[model samples]
Target chain A: MDDAPNSEHFTLSPIGHMVSDYPDKFGIPRQPGLAPAANAKLVLAAPYNDPLAVRGLEDFSHLWLSFIFHQSPQRWSPLVRPPRLGGNKKVGVFASRSTHRPNRLGLSLVRLVGIDTQQGVVLALQGCDLVSGTPVVDIKPYLPWAESQPDAKAGFAPQTPSLLAVSFHPAALDTLTQRSDSATLHALIEQVLSQDPRPAYKQKELASKRLYGVRLRDVDVKFRQRQQGEATTLEVMAIEPYDER
Target chain B: MDDAPNSEHFTLSPIGHMVSDYPDKFGIPRQPGLAPAANAKLVLAAPYNDPLAVRGLEDFSHLWLSFIFHQSPQRWSPLVRPPRLGGNKKVGVFASRSTHRPNRLGLSLVRLVGIDTQQGVVLALQGCDLVSGTPVVDIKPYLPWAESQPDAKAGFAPQTPSLLAVSFHPAALDTLTQRSDSATLHALIEQVLSQDPRPAYKQKELASKRLYGVRLRDVDVKFRQRQQGEATTLEVMAIEPYDER
Candidate 1:
């Protein structure tokens, strides 16, 4: 139509950056709250660090963070196969919350635990799905009454993704005990490995016998997949301090 | 930290534009589902309009629309006074759902009524707050389990904004009777006026006695404010077709 409004382009700058436990995308939960013990913080930058800016933020229990899918491929396709859909059956990119979107923007609902103004404004967030050092473009308080629709159908992913049973060998348990934050570290590893972050296509296949390793925080978790009845299970074989070299 | 990742810049092209009754920003509902009667259609652009791109989208009752605030000022403040807080208290732009932000990007959850693919894709959305012809950069089906938080506390405007009692004068009733879509027009007028879309500063002043008008759809609604004790009421005095001149 002649009255149609033209779309205007704008440049966006990061107001903050996230410091998360998951160094790479390999072991990060697909969504927030899935990893309750996952610790992260949004460190504000420049003018955004003013303490007065977040005066009333503590009252809200949850917040929505809009961040870029920094590691996703730049090219986007209209249709994508969602891992939740067993990586089969193509669905529209708009239908699935795939990161390969027109704009690689991601929206995640994270629990707001506390705000630390001692060293600038760092929002202590729990259950974050972002990888370490992800740039955050925007944040907004999650209004429950207006946002929640518990009964609304979720289409493909209707229920919470089933979790895998995780077990650690004696050697792995001993390594975990050596850490100063042993209790917290153990819980974090169990919570993360329970999701079975293996590729969707590999979920049903029998054990490949390959020792798969994923870097979480400052440690490298080595695990192997084992067939458990109708489901697959993960066994932690080793936990070694991450070697940057 | 030396390991901190650098923020990368991205350029996004709009996939669609909305056509709605709200021509300007003045009386638009601050959030979606606030104005259920406010009808809008997101007409998809080329490439994005492929029928396959919308497959299985209808199964989801709601969708998340990522749009730009085309009319907002280019510059943003770290803190802003939200009208819900009586426009007195300042909250971080991130803590409040303010339009003026680094990206000018807004995420709104809208009820997806239907999808028409006969001539390109046209999604019928209800309870959307987007202005007419607003550019839509991305659309994703709202996953209830992931997005909803029924019990989370909402700061400032915790509950829905209160509605005011609206009455139509005899003259206004007469004007409505002459309209072809009288029933729909009457409902639209009632739905909009009930919100009491006045400036926060002007809402409490008793009996301003001034005739206020707002444009909804193709009509200019003329009404007056009357204070009834603690509650404010609106009386529709006349309804005139919007004057394009």
Candidate 2:
């Protein structure tokens, strides 16, 4: 018998597309489980929607999602700047979870909230960093015993990044209160801003006045940062309906 | 602009093939790290063999390998009988790390022992559960802080499977002593058999005498089980070269 198996290339179609709260990639959390209020749904495609495909998925509390970094640049480099490493030092692409890979594939672990099999299989997920409409190729249940290694040493990101204090002005709070889904919007803003979504170099600058806006659902959230001694504060300036034409 | 991303399919090619000690699937460990003595190498293919593809990978102690379960059966069932569950109780295919799935993909975490870039890039791996000739698609460094969750609960496989005691017959030990790599061969047999690689149902049977043989490298290892009160002992009867014609 031949010792070597056949060497062949394979192709796969997207199994589903994720509908997430973040309309664009900017301000998205670096990893899942960082923003619990951010929820998404994986809407299955034609042939993959059968309930049989996900029969025992509910037993697993978390899942591994193999997705495409659709919005990232197409070309790949040997080294990349990781946001966790302050985005200045270049590390090997394989070492850092950069988007520009030979294959634009991204792996994420997300909490599995529920699965709807009524019309089709719609997977409810929480704490996802993927932007809205990300194409997901494969989904596998996370096996904690086999996958987790709590004592293993982490090279660069040894601990979770410190969070910035977030507060909204009365004008922004009043606008959020008038919205039908006020609680979700309020939590989404707090979750997004607490991560201090700014360029790594810009993060250290104290009191530099620059307003940033991130689109979430049908709203535009405007926020600014201020230096408070050792800690940074994110203040929500306004919240208004996003105009698209 | 529409918030939804373009729905498109993606294709991937095998980056390399694993050269493992176990020629067949039966004696392979159920998970990695079960048999640390067993080693394998991923010999890179064209294009992927470029050293730049794996630059800085040595910095990581472990890596996540996405591979194909090429030798598994073509069809899959929603419910699969896991050996951990004694092969009687059926659970969702996603819940268990069954080889058969909608896609023939398998994921494993292996220790990076070394990398040979002299002729072509060959990645030396330890504690691999993959069978020989398995196709590997992608390799990513494992970040312990993000990937490891020591506190996470494991549903079915909560702890390492119990090991069976093993002993060698006088005749078998003499035959192994004549081999050039006797030390390695001895350790291989002991490591492989201690996992009790029998069918889950057969494990409970007290004294049913059945001889079994497994092929590793260029040799065939024969062993039989004998019950010792509550524990089972595997006695190696013989070790001979595996002939291929």
* Index of the highest-lDDT prediction: 1
Deviation (Å) of A217 in candidate 1: 0.7
Model 2 stretches astray by more than 4 angstroms: A1-7, A204-207, A228-231, A243-245, B1-8, B204-207, B243-245
**After TM-score superposition, what is the CA distance of residue A238 in candidate 2 from its true location, in Å?**
2.2
Clashing pairs in 1: none
lDDT of 2 by residue, A159-245 (tens): 777888899989999999998899988998898888888889888788778998988767889988877787789899999787661
Q: Each prediction's Cα lDDT score?
A: 0.83, 0.80
Question: Per-residue lDDT of B168-221 in model 1, one digit per residue for the tens?
Answer: 999999999998888877887788888877888887679699888888888888
Chain A only: TM-score per candidate: 0.95, 0.94
**What value does the lDDT take at residue A162 in candidate 1?**
85
Interface C-alpha RMSD, model 2? 3.4
CA shift at B69, candidate 2, in angstroms?
1.6
